[model samples]
Target: MTNEELQTLVKTISIDVFKKPFLHQAKHNPRLRTTGGRYMLADHTIEINPLVFKVHGMDELVGVIKHELCHYHLHLEGKGYRHRDEDFRKLLNETSSPRFCKPLAAQNKKSTSFYIYECESCKLKYKRKRRVNVQKYRCGKCAGAISIQINK
Candidate 1:
């Protein structure tokens, strides 16, 4: 959705869910990375990661909005607004807002490479970028046998 649409949606959600109107602006912020949305403490505005809607759809978008709204309303009322606050936690439960925004599918789409190994005797863990010969390798700490598991 466009920034205008996002603004309208945030306003609507603020009223419908919080019983409080959202006076500040809401917009899609391209610079937002892993976060689904952010509530600006300075301006009381909301910035949403556009990839939220693009990768997860409307439900996820609404979830992000709701999460940010918790911050918005609590901060405005001078109550506990941060993620760790009791008031914020209560409001989140009351409004059914997600504790944390869901990770965007786009983030999961990035290429990943890793090799996991566990020593047979000592159960020590190791991660490496390249594959290693299990028979030739041993745990450094205990000199236990090593095995490899590739993850991508």
Candidate 2:
């Protein structure tokens, strides 16, 4: 959604859940890598990760907005606003906001290891993560001698 839309949503959520008005800005921040949303203590503005909407959908986006709003309202009212604060925790529970943001799907990709080997007799394909000596290791399917292949 656009920044204007985000601003409107934040304002609506603030009043609906916290019974307070949010007079600060709310905008999509593409630079936000891990966090779903962040509340700026100095400026009271809220920055939301655009990927949250794309990856997790509107419900997650609303939850994140609520989470940040907890910080926003609490900080504005001179109450405990940090994650460890009792006031913050209580507000979170009252509003049903998530304690922590959900992990991004893009950050969940697995890393894989690649290894290469060759058959001594037929020069067949082989791949492994650990090295195997030709004298001790043989191809299981063909029972052929195995050798490591280094690529230049």
Candidate 1 lDDT tens digits, 2-106: 888888999999889989999999998988887998999998889999988888889989998999999999998999999999999999999999998777654
RMSD of each: 5.9, 7.0
Q: What is the lDDT of residue 48 in candidate 2?
A: 98
In model 2, which regions exceed 4 Å deviation? 108-152
Show model 1 residue runs off by greater than 4 Å.
106-152
Give, for candidate 2, the lowest lDDT window spanning 10 residues.
Answer: 105-114
Kindly list the per-residue Cα lDDT of model 2 for residues 108-152, writing each as its tens digit. Answer: 645466568888788787876666676887887789888778632
Superposition error at 144 for model 1 (Å)? 21
Task: At residue 22, give the lDDT of candidate 2.
Answer: 91
- Sliding window of 10 residues with minimal summed lDDT for model 1: 103-112
